[model samples]
Every structure is written in structure tokens, then in C-alpha cells.
Target: MSFLHSLGLFATLGLIYGCSTTSSLTSAQQRDAYLQQFIGQTSQSIQARLDLNSIGYQQVLAPVANDQTLTYTVIRPVTIPVPIAQNPADIDAGNIPIPVTPRAQSYDVNLQCKIIFRLENNMAKSVYYTGRTC
Candidate 1:
């Protein structure tokens, strides 16, 4: 392979590796990666950049002495699969369907994720998250 061809191949491989690694990250990992950008940003800046109303996140502020804690709470819908009672008439006779087999019914429930930013002098010192969705 020529020099240019070899360089192009390496670049393609690097992109593939980078994409695979990013795709394998869990939901919490992805959230943390996205929230990490706000570290050291001022509260005003964070407020301006993060559209709480548009994104469905509820913003709350808690004052602790001189320091403050800013929390963003969002409810995420989680679909839970539960085994439902199977009707005998619904089973096909030709297929010999087992009556003991359970059919799953999905139900959506609201799960909340709380993003907390610790602020000192109105500047975000650190950030973390808690709750089921996180």
C-alpha cells in the first residue's frame, strides 16, 4: 500500500474503534460524559446552556451555608415487562401451544434521575447524579 492509502486505513480503523467504544458505554456513563462538560462553569452559564423546561428537567436550588447545590430532576419512562395471564382460547390448537407459557405485558413507569451540581461561590465545583434512571 502507498503512504496515503496506509494513512487512510489507519484513520478509518481509529474512527471504527472510537465509535465502538462510545456505543458500548452505559446510560449512566453517557450521562456523566455529557454532564462533565459543565464542570467549572458558572451557574448562570449552566442555566443558559441547559434548557430545563425544554428538556423536561426540573431545576432546584438548595443553599448550604456559603456553598450551594443545584439539582436537575428529570423523569424517564421505563417500560417493564410483566407476565400476563394467557387466555386458553387464544392458543392455537395446531401449534400445540403450551398453556403454561406466560405472555409478557409491558407497562411504563416513571423513573427519575437527579443531576446534582455542587457550587462554591456560584461556580460549579463538581457534578454527580443519583436515582434509578441514572
Candidate 2:
């Protein structure tokens, strides 16, 4: 009974240690980590993994003889609040109500982030990002 109890305690401690050691990355970090997989991958493989036909995908330029840059723009939706008068009341005999009460009206804006992939010898070498969304 003592041996079994010790083994069970060790197993529980191991499980707890494993769980504690595990970590979760943020959305941007996870995205960057996923994009890193394209490094050292051929253009064909990267194209196969990503949707090349998407509206955001474009071929920017080839700087050197064997170097090329592919740009991918990601559109993100952002909410912008525009203050508008939501309540307005005239003055009553007893008291005067506020002429205008400003309330937030949300409007969605499509922000963009341009990701550039540099390729050499048809293999992706590095990745860069630009624009406000990045």
C-alpha cells in the first residue's frame, strides 16, 4: 500500500508540473509563429498552404536576380465610436432638461496589415509586416 501511494503521488506531481510548464501565446504571437513555418519552405509549398487567390495576395517585386517579395494584406475590422446626440429634451416648467446627451455610436473600419515575404531561390527566407494593423 505504501509503494502504490508513493507512485500515485509522483504521478500526480508530474502531471501538475507538466500542466504548469505549458504556456499559451497571444493571438499575434501565435499568428507569427504559424507564419514562421513558411520559412525555408518553397514558394510552391507556401502557396499550397495559403490561399494565393485571395484578394489580399499580391506580388510586389523582385529586388535582386533571385530575390522576390510577396505581399499579403490582411483586413481587420475596427470599431470607431462617433459621438452623437442620443437624447434631447426641452425645458419643462419645473426643471430644464439637458439640451443634448452625447452617446457613442460605433462604426466599423477596415484596417489593413501588409505582410511581405522575401524569397530567394524560390524558397521563403524571411517575413516582414507593415501598416497600422501590424
Q: Which candidate comes out best when scored by TM-score?
A: 1
Candidate 1 residue spans exceeding 4 A from truth: 1-25, 51-67, 83-104
Worst 10-residue lDDT window for candidate 2 reads 56-65
* TM-scores of the models, in the order given: 0.55, 0.51
RMSD of 1: 15.4
What TM-score does candidate 1 get on C-alpha atoms? 0.55
Give the alpha carbon lDDT tens digit for every residue of 31-115 in model 1: 6666778889987788668654444334444322235877776665444443333345656544455544232333345656777
User: Candidate 2, residue 22: CA error in Å?
Assistant: 25
Superposition error at 102 for model 1 (Å): 16
Model 1, residue 123: distance off in Å is 1.0
Residue pairs with backbone overlap in model 1:
none
Candidate 2 per-residue lDDT over residues 1-134, each given as its tens digit: 47567656655665455434332246457667777888998777775686422322233332222359656666654444433322233333445544442332344456556777898888899988897454
